[model samples]
Target: MESNLKWLRSCDLLIQNAYVFESALCRFVQKDVAVKDGLIVDVDKALALDSQKTLDGSGKYLIPGLVDIHMHIESSMTWPGAFYKQALRWGTTTLVADPHEIANVAGLEGIHEMISNALSLDIFFGIPSSVPSTREDLETTGGILDEGEVSELLKDPHMRCLGEVMNFNDLKQEDSKTRRLIQLCKQMRPDFLIEGHCPKLTGQDLSIYLAAGVDADHTHQTPASILEKAAKGMFLEIQDKSVTLENVQTLVTHALYDHFCFVTDDCMADKLYAKGHLNEVVKKAMAYGMPQTQAIYCATYTPARRMHLDDRGMIAPGKKADLVLLRDIASWQIEAVFKDGKPIASYPIPEASFSLSLYHSIHLDPLTEEIFQLHGYQGKAVQANVMVIEPHSTFTHRVIESIPIINGQIAYEKVGLNLVMVFERYGKNGQHAFGFVRNALQSSAALATSWAHDHHNLMVMGNDAKKMCKIANQVIACQGGYGIVDDHGQAMVHLPVGGIISDGPLAVTASELEEVTRRMRQAGYVHDHPIMSFATLSLPVSPELKITDAGLIDCRRQQIIPCIERVLTDEDND
Candidate 1:
């Protein structure tokens, strides 16, 4: 095998007969080019540099490789290789991924898997910071990562900066551990790029957040929100997760596009293979009235600069030579992709390994039949507790005390009942939190996942504690999976992707999710889509109310409260 560095001394191939976007608005054309090894040593009109191969790109458009500032590899349901294969098909050459979901489920081992996967691939790694997310008492997690644990993880070359700091509430309220984390990262990398996760912050609070040296955000839910933060100098990561073409339109017309870049925070696998990655985002921007050049720059230079990735994201000499050729500016379809100046056949698989331990389960022991047994039904119906899902956001609606009970038990409106259970998956006992849910659940035997965001603990909610117990136990039974049991007491569906993702394709998972949705609707769930989002809304770290293994958490107050009222229900309120 020839060394790429040795090949750099002589040109291997070049193409110069194509239009190229040199800068935001400049367009230049050349007749011949030179690629030595895997680097573009020289590009010129005259064929001056010696080359081994040459190609005519008469009608193509050349541009720098597209970079994704923030994304999760697991969301695609495919491993990192599939992510790169699909991403490269659309001209995405690099990415920055947060393995928080995996970290919540697997802890240090999870971090190791992410590090390995990232090393195997040609992407960047933003080290995960908030491993368990909220405080331990607020919820259950598969694992936790403190400063000491994370500092060791950051030593890898692929580990660039701290992952998204999702616990802004903890940092803002002056939690010592949270404060220590910030200080530690700062001390280690004085100029490190710390990602922010302040969703819907405003005024003085936003000011304080910025003052804390937070750098970027992908949580802008509105155009005004983007403008507000951009004016304050925060790099806004324009996203396609919740934002559609309509939202992109509002952004390009209303806000300054320069401060914003493109990101697909949670695009499913089908979307990547079908539509594209950052390249699709650029087309979406142009369709919304953004100039072609500006859209490309936002996808390339803007995010690259924000991430401080100097060697990539541009078409300059003495760089890594990652480049993309486009069919045109309007469509933005990728013609070819190059990594290190060589046309890559496919995306490389990331350095990753399958690992499972006590950290993978919210509870080590499965929920036993005794724990989920029901005594009898009572006629004294009253209000219970509930967790609400926020639309188009990572945050959840707070855990509220406004739920209805039926026959002396909590019921979800006339749909069925709301039941919640927590399993101790960390190989410990006597500290597990369990309780009831009302209103939010939409089915009779339907159970939802407790990844409950940030924390990877198992918080299964259903109308039947036995069924919830079965679902919770199934997680242990299968190592990791979201489960739903029919009223007939059968395991209806299971998704076992690292306990958080499903190895099944997205469509199959979506179908299984649909089955869960159908059961919920049949039993009386009244939500627009399936209550899958309800699983995330149950997170205690975000806003509103949420339930953890510890108990019901008031996100606004950052504290846990009793699942049941201390006094008589109806009489007490009266």
Candidate 2:
């Protein structure tokens, strides 16, 4: 809040000037704006002034600073600080972030890091609710949080609401733990907000979910879904990844814009740089035929209203000064960005070089010997059920089938590997659980993430029992990170950021991830980086299928089902 009078005196500042748009029916341009005490003191036709800094608004527009309703900073593949620097440069002055990835793996420590990062910048934190996403005991997580933890999180100054509560089916079933956590948040903050994750929920199930006090949803797959949720008073978050310009066109044409707001639930660093942030969403919406004012409203007022951020969604007196100055409305080019009435970003961009320092693992040690023991199998072939997940969607697909059981052990199948096993890394017990899956991890090598979906667990995916055990140990040895090893027992790549992020620059991490993905492809794996895919697979709240340490999960049934038939096969012994 330092004063900038050196640049404000001697005819230094311009008078009132603004390019105004309202209600999709009116547009006006004026030249009169005065800055003092870091707030727009006045805006009118003219003001007699001796200013030191004067900016010409010959033909430009002034709008409120953009707000991103929902986003995951972990998806940026960069640390929080680095993401903030780059994001601010693009006019994202305020962001609502869900640190579910870190919370899953590192538990409260992860959430603490998120809070610290948010405090360090102009941002808000939405505490994650579903950790160890599913109640699967077969997996080992970084940590766990019950009602007590949620209560503590809610007390934070930055805590806005309980993050996306993924276990909707469990909520429907009246699960005690789930209910208690939600109730705890309510007690902590009477009008507490809870985000939703019911992708295909409808009819009675949807009603029950809405009744639980969940206020918003980012998983709307269709206009019908948005309409259904809106009918129940849920704020629909329009996603950039799932809802593109083509589909946005349909929503705008249908005039279903009021109940919706824009959010980039997961935009990678590369895409954020190329396409822009909240501003991009606004521009795309306009190009798709959404009225410019409507687009601006969706990007600003609507989300601010939903979040209850009453202090700064408009450009009037008494409102916190957060504004975006644009060169034009058509191209949506940002000219300058301001926060609290002081220009924070302008032309002549600085070189973008970001770095992360990770102290190598010193407290953890690698297992030089085999740590897993298997039982209940006999020969070379066996039957098993599998789990599958679609791309860019929250729900998973569970399938049951028969496959090869090699050497008295279940083999990792490439074309249709149905079941995969998970071992707890923190426990010497080496408890092994299996589940059915499809559409990812086309390789036999194990893929682990401390960044597992809802609950950060030591999630390992591989068909080979021996390699799965080995990779799990390696991940544990690194204390946390992602590791992929070949079917022939060869190490491919390792990025040990609490088993979640890479302690390197975004470009470096992206390059290493590219190499790991390349190796997966070379190893006969057909899917993309199965590493990032596993993060969502453990989320019990999404839908269809997922696995925790418990075993193969039937999310709808809210219980773990066996992946194999009762009969034992010869291959189970390997």
Candidate 3:
């Protein structure tokens, strides 16, 4: 080893005994990688060089550290630091987080708060392009992200790209604040990505969405739409639900693999820990006939490129020495992870310090069981717009359900029907909305969550008004969190941080959620993740129809409509 060597071969770390995937193509070859001061100095011929530290790769195959280009850290319901603790162990070195969930409540300040919390990890941000997501009038969000705030936030180096451009219809309508924000982001980071959430959009509508410079969509997709989107030069950000065996085969078989990337856009803590992060996506892809190498490529280089992060996605000379070592590419067992040329070491998860305002996020007046009551005016049979949940998907189906008003109220005491209610927890107004969710739960259980999509409103669902009130009040009592009330008394997971992410260790939070799920299931609540069944009920963007704090939105029409068709008789009117 010579100090004055031209290539600086006297490195800080040298990783030997390995086969490295050189690029996005995940080509494997025998190589000795050299790292100097957190950056790779040479790939080959460094075998004989002396270094301060060395990691014997043994029988492992080295791949670039996984990069998840699209996700909302809040969705995991864990603090960002806790997320890093788990995700890093599963081979994720970098994350392109969208803090839009918190931003919806606290605006730019919320984004900054998330940034401050994640100061220790490899976290980049996509400025929440659609904070309120869409029409603020419909959803009572506490803060707003207009052009000015977004432009100011874009100045931060961490703002790698714009967050999900949710309002696809606005792009075609050529109106609203979203237009100016998109233009500003385009001007700011012309080459960076603009993520999207356009599901069921095709042909002209898809073209229109792409034309607005929104380059990717992470929503659920079918084979036809995936092919169409890829054909239009748009990147497909696939998640767990969207990555089916058929879709995976179509993407790899057509050689459209490079245009696709894997993302855990909204994984819960249990899912994040129990199931691997991007590693799970890679395994699922491989099981679907995708070669292991291509799966690795989609998880690493493709997402890095989409986020304009070219410096760290490859194990090449002059690249950042962030990498993942696996015992075998087939089994996908993570042996070790290294960031900045140092092996990841297990330690206690770091706690996030926040300002006073963030400690108690939910602000609302008390509510009685009366608020959950639904009635057809004058006690008449009416045709009502009911929210119908498709199995295993967040997308809701709008159905014209018939309601027979009994006595003075229209109640859903039936087995398959449940009362769905949303309260504006931000206290923007005392206004709340009520509707019936049919076929959501099989056992008629009451579950309440303050984790409603972009806007974290308080929501409760069940056939039991007393139980619904109990759950909702329990969630409120926790300051802001999730709660379920059944024969088991009450179970709540406290997420004091914005009422979305729990401020506890990932393990604790994951375990608690698992317990809550088990109890809810035991209580006869039959749905995949009953909490999400209520949580996503208020998201304005997901397909078909969705409910907001204002009322039931005909998502396609992008407006509030009466849940029931009020048929009035002359005698009843008088």
Candidate 4:
């Protein structure tokens, strides 16, 4: 390392008298910070000599660039180059991401591409701990990352943490693959972070999860439960849906600011551009009565410490100069962004390119309108189990509804019912399952996506079978992406490689995703986001009833249940 005293003060960038976030001070203080060769060399009156460049921080809050300890770049529907550059302007400097979306589709090859792209920027990865998430009976994924893949990835310096272990239900079971993956991680890097995806787990279940070496959770939980998890020594990675005013109040009153961090675990591209990335989390926490410094701390240092990344979370000497300058701290408006001691500028990032296998991910047989038809037995009416959509939540409610059969088929003309189906798009078994959905996609609308959470299977639902088929075919045509059909006509955003994300510019992708949202709203859907609607439908880790390519799964029991119930024959009734 070069000696700080040997360098002239006029060497590089100088930021003076800004409200710098001081970890040791536990608050902001007016201090001059100097950077050389992309690392902070000195602070507290370091810029007394002439400087080559200077940015006065008058009326500005100089902060260490926000670090998102947990997120999925694919959730933004953009590649690392685009997501990193787009989020930087919003004050996010470093990202710890999970590449399981691609891992599900392409296994080690996918993980390698994600790592290579992220290595070009301040992006680090948690090795995808659960590829294919669950067993093959519940869902089908194109790829599987076993012990061999995990061992290979652990050698890469960028692989800092083990990805979210979505197999929460299997931890207590002796022969679970999740346990093997966790044990492998422990054997490799005993200090590596193991992230979690357990939502609504409490008491003994929570204890079991923690005992399995889970160090963090990014799932939905109540304020009380959040406190309990943190108290039990598991770091909380709070997302937007769980960040109500009530929860924030509980956290602020206790001031366990160091125990938790703000993370946008799954932010879409359009929402990322409109609201902001993790900066939005900082703003919301402030609104919930968190002090500015504390909120900033949660967004910055807390997460970095969780990942054990000591190189770039602060502005002290020897830390990488990842800085975000804010015009106003209250609104969290970013004035400028600098990474590696250089300013970031707004420009369209080119689309990412990949190998032929990534491009040829779709392995589905051609689907038609007839494939969406719901067949009925020899009964006038039968009771059916339906997957109920609870707005703004990844969890679904399982409800029983009586269905009146007409002409030996389930009625498509029902007032509040929509046809939901999942196709094993990965070419694993070439299987498909049909189910019923209630209280979503109302009528005259359909949406299909290969970006279905965990499995990356083909998930589509709608009132119109023809339209649903059209959307599914569109996804097949592109190999992966989102397709929507409403009264306003049809629109598509082709994500070709794995259907989870695109190589396209984020600006272009965000605009197209925004258009899809607008069309979804116009068609009378009331979900907070349509992409969330598409992604969560197949994620079995979500609570209650969720659909998989195999069928509707009762997530709590971790077993497949019938979407439609059979009616007793007259002979049996007698």
Cα RMSD (angstroms) for every candidate in the order listed: 4.4, 5.3, 2.5, 2.2
How many backbone clashes does every candidate have? 21, 58, 3, 1
Error of 4 at 78 (Å): 1.0
Higher-scoring candidate on lDDT, 1 or 2: 1
Regarding TM-score, does 2 or 3 come out ahead? 3
TM-score of each: 0.84, 0.81, 0.95, 0.96
Question: Which numbered prediction scores highest in lDDT against the true structure?
Answer: 4
> In model 2, what is the error at residue 262, expressed in angstroms?
1.1
Regions of model 3 farther than 4 Å from truth:
346-350, 375-377, 523-525, 567-574
Q: 1 or 3: which has the higher TM-score?
A: 3
- Tens-digit lDDT string for candidate 4 (1-574): 3554558445488898788889755688888888888888888854685667988987777889999988998888888988888898898989999899899889999988887776667788989988777777888888889888999999888988899988877778877778888888889888877889888788888888998989689887688888889888888988887788988988888888888899999888987877799988888888888888888888888888888888877879899889988888888777788888888773334346677788888888779888887764677666788888877876679888777667777784474788888888767788888788776776598989888888988989898888999989988988888889877788877797677788877778888888887877777677876668757878887788888889988888889998767663444441
Model 1 Cα shift for residue 95 (angstroms) = 1.6
lDDT of 3 by residue, 465-547 (tens): 88888888888878777777776576777788878877778888888788778777776555766667668888877767777
Report how far off residue 220 is in candidate 2 (Å). 3.6
Alpha carbon lDDT of each predicted model: 0.65, 0.64, 0.81, 0.83
Which tens-of-lDDT digit does each residue in 259-323 have in candidate 1? 77888776654466566777776777777777777778888887888888877666656656777
For residues 9-125, could you state the per-residue lDDT of candidate 2 as single tens digits?
Answer: 323245345674332333445656666554555555666666556666657777666778688887766666666666766667778888877765556776786666556566787
Order of quality (TM-score): 4, 3, 1, 2
